[model samples]
Target: MLHNFTYVLFKLKLIQPSQKAIRFWMDCEDTDKLEFALKHGNYKTRKLAAEALEQIAKPCSIPALLNCINDKVQNVSVACLNALERISPNDELIKTIVRKRFNWVNEIREKRAKYEANKHVKHTIYRWRRTSKESYDRVKEQLKKPIR
Candidate 1:
């Protein structure tokens, strides 16, 4: 279990809490190590590591997470996607989904776009005519329904 690296890592004042720590994680190079760091590493550690590794858009970590896509737990895939998306948005996995127009990704993006556009329109309308709580709730509830 690489306990030496893990334990010594936290205690080292030599490495600042930000970029230095991230570089250490990146140097680990092993996708398994990176994945372990991502899952078990502290939030600031994970977030910085993901961001740093992302700018480089290393391909190693992306494939590691791809295998996790089919994980039974929904959040596992979501987290995998989140990490992979950060690491490399243009990576094949994302591009494949974009190219294929996978229903899941397409629907989610479309729904989010629609909701944002609707919210802007509603906000403008509300400025002119004060929206009732009931009316706003009805609109929001209606938007929540799955598209046929």
Candidate 2:
């Protein structure tokens, strides 16, 4: 069957997972393929899946996107956060994640300014702080729109 063939190709990396996800987005009503890409594919695949989900803005993808916010890769996490903003701006989970990240950024900034931290920790925190601020801004912009 075509499904088995596609899965084999995906597993072999013969076809990019993102491309597969896009194909599924166009051909399927459900997000089974996209969710598979997010869960099993590489970081680039996960990022692309998030982007596709954002474009689709399907409510069904919200839960999967929410889980992606915790992805170990920064790019994947950011993509998921942005997708969540597009899909459900008013969701309490989105609000909580954005607010938490924003507050964490503030705390990092204050700590970095007030105390002398290890060089590695400082570098890591700096990156996280910057990303958190950007994510907060994006979520805030999304929230500004009147709920439909």
Candidate 3:
């Protein structure tokens, strides 16, 4: 209970905790709590939660982490990928699931159009820029290869 409240305080910027402390808080075996935070928390919290999941190495986190692979926050997405790697290393099933979830070609076109249409981009909006294609290609290749 205290940990949950601490997280709320952390979310509100009322308390500044060390990474170790945050990681400790995330050490619970509850995938549901972590999943909720991953889906709803701000980028920093989401990234931290991913790191916690990585430490815990829970297979249950795979779906949530997979969905976050396209997160608008690049670092959060990377953290999710790292967690997924740790939890499901060498799993070909993950690769296929990722491929099914993302249609790179279509998503690229769509994100770009949305970015162009928006005068002020929200934190969650994703648009292709200089490294977008390259990043996508790299992620594709990584997903193709069994996690190393």
Candidate 4:
């Protein structure tokens, strides 16, 4: 079958590191391969894979992108964040995740509760809401100041 042939060719290209594979990872209509590359491939491959996935404009991929937010690499995290921003899902699930992240007043408390709720991760994000509130106040003061 043609699908099997395409699958074989995809696997071969991924193993061989061809430009075609990168392109397929980037621009192909297959979200499955893009998700796989984003999670398991090397940095360059994952970066391009994230970019391509962002361009696909599909809501179904946001959960995978959300998982990428916890990646250790800063660029990878940023790419995933920006991509999720681009996808802009109106679903309650995505909305809840984003709101939980950006909700300044309770962001840290909520994150702490969530992290503590999970005993797997060792480190927790601390002082985020405090620092965020301080930064917000400073920015607000600056905005209120009259330009000379």
Candidate 5:
């Protein structure tokens, strides 16, 4: 009962505790509490929860960690990624990450194409300028010597 109350206080911001303490509590094998913390806790708490889940290495925690992979906080996402790696996620998680990776690659390609298209003339001029001076002079002389 006291443990539950302390947890509630922690959740409600009535108490601020160290991440080590939170990690110790999570090691008690309460997946529900760990999941809740992962989903709703502050970044540090979420990170600790992910580490605890990694230490537990329970397959059941895979889904929760997978869901956290897209967390806005980089630390939380990194922790979740590390936890997922340690848990040896199932095929679904692998497929999801692959799909997301492909989508990200496609997006980057599209953006690069757009940028290139927009700057094509500038790129050509820059490339021409970057050539060796001898090659540039040869090209200039060739252009000056008009065809018969």
Candidate 6:
């Protein structure tokens, strides 16, 4: 009865899905749903989905995580970075790429002054943000059919 009620609420879109809801989807090994949440959910939900992807550690999730690694929200971006770090350690190229992103994320924070003043990293961050959003939008359009 409780499950049905929540399902009805979700179907009606009465409230945007919560992080815990996305976590449940993760436990079901529903990567498609996680990808959708990572793109569409608020920062909290996106972070949760990224952490879930980290735990699930599937190669299929890398693209979705990459799409959001430049998230404007620090928490969400860090979560994505962590997910990418764990998911692709065996792949040298991807590991190097994620390391660069991890550095970029750190550089923007004033607390980490090492590269914070680097103009090149600052510009790259903005460019990556735009590129990531565009790719996410494209994927979102292609997946127009609702999740089951």
Instruction: Judging by lDDT against the true structure, name the best candidate.
Output: 6
lDDT of 6 by residue, 108-141 (tens): 7655575555645644344336888889999999
Candidate 3 backbone collisions, by pair: none
User: What lDDT score belongs to each candidate, Candidate 1 first?
Assistant: 0.56, 0.75, 0.74, 0.70, 0.76, 0.79
Clash list (residue pairs), candidate 5: none
TM-score of 6: 0.65
lDDT of 2 by residue, 83-135 (tens): 88887888787878966764655676788776765544634344335888889
TM-score of each: 0.38, 0.58, 0.54, 0.51, 0.57, 0.65
lDDT of 3: 0.74
Candidate 5, residue 34: Cα displacement in angstroms equals 1.3
Clashes of each: 0, 0, 0, 0, 0, 0
User: What does candidate 4's lDDT look like per residue over 29-131, in tens digits?
Assistant: 6888778778876677677778778888787888788887767665676678668877986567666665654454256568878878886867766754688
**lDDT-best of 4 and 6:** 6
3 or 6, greater by lDDT: 6
User: Candidate 5 at 120: error in angstroms?
Assistant: 26
TM-score winner between 3 and 4, please give it.
3
Better TM-score candidate (5, 6): 6
Candidate 4 lDDT (Cα, 0 to 1): 0.70
Name the regions of candidate 3 deviating beyond 4 angstroms. Answer: 7-21, 96-148
Summed over model 6, clashes come to 0
C-alpha-based local distance difference test score of model 2: 0.75
The model with the greatest TM-score is 6
lDDT of 6: 0.79
Task: Give candidate 4 regions above 4 Å deviation.
Answer: 1-19, 89-148
TM-score computed on alpha carbons, candidate 4:
0.51
RMSD value for candidate 1: 15.5
